[model samples]
Structures are given as C-alpha cells and as structure tokens.
Target chain A: MSDLFPEEVRTERLRLECESVADADLGERYASMNETAIEDGELAYVPIEPFEHLQEARDFVAQREDRMESGDAGTYVVRPRDGEDGAGYPAGEAELFAVWDERTAFMTFGLRKRFWGRGYSGERAAALLRLAFERLGVELVSVTHLVGNENSRRAIGKYVDRFDGERVGRFRNQHVIDGEPRDVVRYEVSKADYEASGERPDCEFVEERADGGDGA
Target chain B: MHVGVANLDCLWENRRVHTGVSLYRPYWGRGYAGERARALLSVTFDRLDLDVASVAHFEGNENSKRQMEGWVEDFGGREDAYIRNAVPRDDGDAEPWNLRSYSITAADYRDAGGAPEVELDPENVPEPTSEPTDLDRANDGGDGA
Candidate 1:
C-alpha cells in the first residue's frame, strides 16, 4: 500500500488516494454514471450506447489503474465531506475520479444525481489540481464535455485555462448514442497556466482512501 | 472557463498567436468555442502574460476557419499573418496545405480583460470583457492608439 501511493495528502475540500485493482466496486459504481454522462457528454460528441453493468466499469477502471501503476497515467479519487454537497457531493452519492496522461486529465466523478448543481465540482477540482501540480508534477491536464453538457462545461470551466478550440476526434469506434460517432469538446490546463490563472493552488479537503477505496 | 495550453514544450517556441481546436459538431452553435478562445486569449495576455496569443486552421475547412474568425474579433486577435500550405489533406496523393493563423497581442488582451469580467454566478469569478461602445472603446485604447 505504501508503494502504491507517494504519500497521503489531505486538503480541506478533498482527499487524494491511489486506486488499486481491489477497488473494482468503485469502478463499477463509476461505470454506473456512464449512462447519465452519456446524456451529458458522449451523446453529444459521438454516438455510444449507454454502458450497463459492473464488469464493463470494472474493466475500464482496471485499464485506468494499469495506466496509473505503470506511470502512463495519473488517477485520483474525490472524497467529498458529508452534507455540504456544494462540491457536487451529496454525502455518499458517488466518487469523483480524474484520469489523465501527461498532457490531459479526463475528470468524471462517479457521483449520483443528488450531487449535481452543487459547487462540488469546482471546489474539489481546485484541490485536485493543486495536488496534481505540487505533488504529481503534471504539465497539462485536459477534459471534454460531450456537447449539451453545459453543466459539465460550466463546472469544468473553473478548473482549466481554456485555450485552443478543439473538438474530440473519433475516439475508437463509437455507437452507443444512436450509431453516430462523436467528437467530445476538449479542454486542457498546464502547470504554468495553472499558476498563472491567479487561482489558489493550495486547496483544503479531508482525507480518504488512496488505492481507490471508498472512504465510506 | 480557462484551460492551459500544452507547456510550450515545443509548442510555444516563438511568440506565434494561434490555438489548436476541435469541438463537437452537436455543440457547434453554442459559441463555447469562441468563449473559450476569448478566455485563452485572456490567459495568454493577462495571466501567462505572453505577448501574442494564436489560433490556426487549414485553408479550406470553413467550419474551423469560421471559429478562428470569431476568435480574432472577440479575443482581440489580429488578422495579419499566414503559413502557406502547411497542412495537407490526406488523399491518394499528399499536398501542402495552408495553415491560417490569428492572434491577440498581450497589450490587446490585457486591456480586454479589465472590463465586464465574465463570471460563472455560482463561481463568482472574473468579469468577462464585453465589447464597449465608442466612449468605452476610446478609454480602453487610452494608453495608446
């Protein structure tokens, strides 16, 4: 477990943990958000059938974990405090997940419907990015809004320094959203840009599981 | 919303003013592309404080071109330069393609950042710089011509 993570880092707004293969249940739950997210994102970018079931979610999370363990990707979980769902947390509704390569971060909190409309996304993201920049030493992080997800767009907009207008190119073969392909609207942020944004990089959050374990 | 450009690793070698962009066709009418471009322009000029912010596209892809055009007008970008046949469409045969460019100088965007700071209500953030009328515009260009 020690080797699995660099060290336990806590902020007033979130707890950053490293996820492990054992945390398949969290992955499963995250996968559950796919159908809803499809309506919010992928449905607008490209066509993709809503994902249903734990196996698929587990598999995807496994892949992401592999990336993290192998140093190809960096993953972090969002554990919001109880109540105060402003950060998109309805106290045990879902887990916030951020996956990324050196240049991009794909953020999706495995949250429930109850978490929406709260300021959870923005506040939590600020803490996460702070950790990403100070500890992870990442250069740029990117995300996408699957068209019509104005909520995602609005929420995500706060975390990144919007630049270059680019749409998601064909990501593999897509068909879940009615057989149409998609181009997820892409967004990104850089270390330099992050610092430059005049945002407070030192954010606050409580602590939680690092290997993708549910704090609950 | 603000997003970081790639760490000028090899991207920001010079003070070129252009952005690499792609947006969903479904969200095409939303003007987010322009909004984001303007915001980036703000970053380049006000935050990172670079002298010029840029954006690019192929010669014929009007869809992409149109977005860049709005960026030029909205983000304080200038329509002064071009890269000839830099991007070639892949056909049976390869060919040189034009990579059109647009940009906002640091001075241009900093001044732009000062007004009507755009805010995301719940977020309560930066006031967006809305286009000013003749008098406001005169004061905006106050420091120089």
Candidate 2:
C-alpha cells in the first residue's frame, strides 16, 4: 500500500517522475519551472498565489514530499523523454491527490507557457490517469478547472472526453479567485468508464517497458 | 423541542459553504427541515456574505431527495452533479455513496428574492406536531433531509 505509485512513469513523449526532495536536481528543476510559471502569469489561473522567493517553491517541494510520505498525494515532474531543446527540462507538474476514504483521487496538472500549445497536456494526463486507475486502484478520478480558464477547459475537455469521463456541470461559485467567487467545471471518470473507453491513451510503467524490452 | 442539527461547513474557501439539515424521526415532515434550511441560507448568503451554499443527498435517500427538490429551485439553486463514490458509509461494509449534489450562489439567492428573513437562534427548537413515522428514515445518510 505504501508503494502504490511507481517512482517513474513513462509515456511515449513525456517522463513523469515522482517528486523527491532527496534528489536536489529534481528539486531545482521543479522550483525553476514554478518560477517560470509565475513569471509567465500562469499562476493567475491557478488557485495559489505566486511564489515570492525561490525558497517558497523549494519549501513547496519539501511539503509535497511530506504529503507523499503520508500517502495523501503523488506529485510528479513532467519532462520530455528526449531532453532535446528546452523540452527536456521540467515542462510542468502533474498531481494526484487521494481521498482515500471514498476511494477517489483528484487529478491536476499544469505546463509552462512554452509547452502549452503542444499535446503534452493530454499526454501527461494519460500517464496520470493510468497511475490513478491501474496503479492506485482508486474507484474514481475527478478533475475541476476554474470556469473562465479556457485553456484548461479545452485541455481537460479533450483528455476527459477521450477517456469517456462525464462532464459534471458547471458548479456555480464553486471557488474563490482573487477574492471573487467563481464557477468551476468538474469532470469525473469512474474505473468502469476508463475500462469501457475505446480511445484511452497508451501508457506503460518504466519497469514494465524495460522488462519486456523486445525487438518486435 | 430538541430536534436535530443544521450544518454550514466551510468547503473550498470562505466564499462557499456546504449546508445541510437533519431532524429526528418524530420531527420528520412538519416543515422544520425546510424552515431551518431557509434560515441557514439566509445566514449563508446574507449574514456570512458567502457566495455559494451547497448540499447533497445519497442516491437512494428519497426523503432527502424530496426535501431538496421541494425548495432548492425556489431558492434559485440548481443540481450540479451526480458524484460517484462521493460519500463514505459509517457502516463500513458497503461501498461509498453516489450523491446528487446542488448549490445556490449569492447571485442566485438574490435573484430568487433570497430566503425569507428569519432570525437564527441556537436554542430555537421546533415542537413536534406529528407522530414519528415508521415509513423511512428522513436522514438516512446523515448528509441531509
């Protein structure tokens, strides 16, 4: 149970590595990507305030480590498998927050501005959903985005639709952004829904891929 | 006179709270649940200055469903989602509950002329006017009634 999620999950185009404070380089990359998101004003759409200093992001990494150790969350750095160009750096972050009592987990992710236009959102989500359903053994995965965030609307919509998730309607005043109440669009994919979807994204655990290293 | 309880739980942020009402079996349908709910909404939107008041009921809890259906729209609320595995059971034997959820924004509350002005009092317990029913539990899931 403690080892429900793997250390690393690989999609065809991205590497989702578990966030670990023991790895100073991974911590640096995580903090650097966060700074980039803050500078790009991407944090405006997210619920959190921008990091005031580099150490804040580093502190956040340490906090996430505590959460992971408590079995309440799994945080991963999203990077391109091929480190060519700037894509090899931490492109974004993917997260799964457990609601263990209900057998459900919340899925959230974000990418730096430079990585936005590409299909990385869906690709990363594919890997995260596989972790939630296949590895974590949760009964349901839920996703919610601030209502006016059109980028997230499109990105979450595409991946959620492909997995046959239900678009639970726009909840009014579901969240507060910048001191103003705002709406949120929620989506959910049950284990049954994922199993029934014909177009689910392909993902493989790194160890599985290495073990089955076949020439076919 | 001591019926049950009403809850206004801070949910996501200060902007929203999840509200629910539960009355003992003897106090089932004298409209105490509705009256308390109306006052709770008044507090939620008017006094608390909160943005939204949300509530939900388990799938098979017809008593709560009827209560919500009766007044949710009159207060300008709407059904938000049917969330699967949303509530855990105290019994610990069966699966988590599938809930039918709803919410009312401050704007919606204002648009519907808001809940009728009612003063909230902690000691204001309603006197039972009807006999306890053996029909069904009004607050089966402890979520709402």
Best-matching candidate per TM-score: 2
Tens-digit per-residue lDDT, A32-127, candidate 1: 455654445323433234557666656655765665566533455445544444342222211223333222334444334455566666665666
Interface RMSD of 1: 16.9
lDDT of each residue in A80-99, candidate 2, tens digit only = 77643564577777888888
What are the lDDT scores of the predictions, listed in order? 0.48, 0.75
Error (Å) of candidate 1 at residue B80 is 17
Which parts of model 1 are misplaced by more than 4 Å? Answer: A1-13, A23-54, A83-110, A161-178, A202-216, B1-145
Candidate 2 displacement at residue A153 in angstroms:
0.7
Candidate 2 residues lying further than 4 Å off, grouped into runs, are A30-40, A83-85, A207-216, B10-13, B91-93, B120-145
Error in Å for residue A129 of model 2:
1.6
Q: After superposition, how far is residue A188 of candidate 2 from its true place, in Å?
A: 0.6
**Cα-based RMSD of candidate 2:** 6.6
Ten contiguous residues minimizing lDDT sum, candidate 1 chain B: B1-10
For every model in order, the fraction of real contacts preserved is 0.00, 0.53
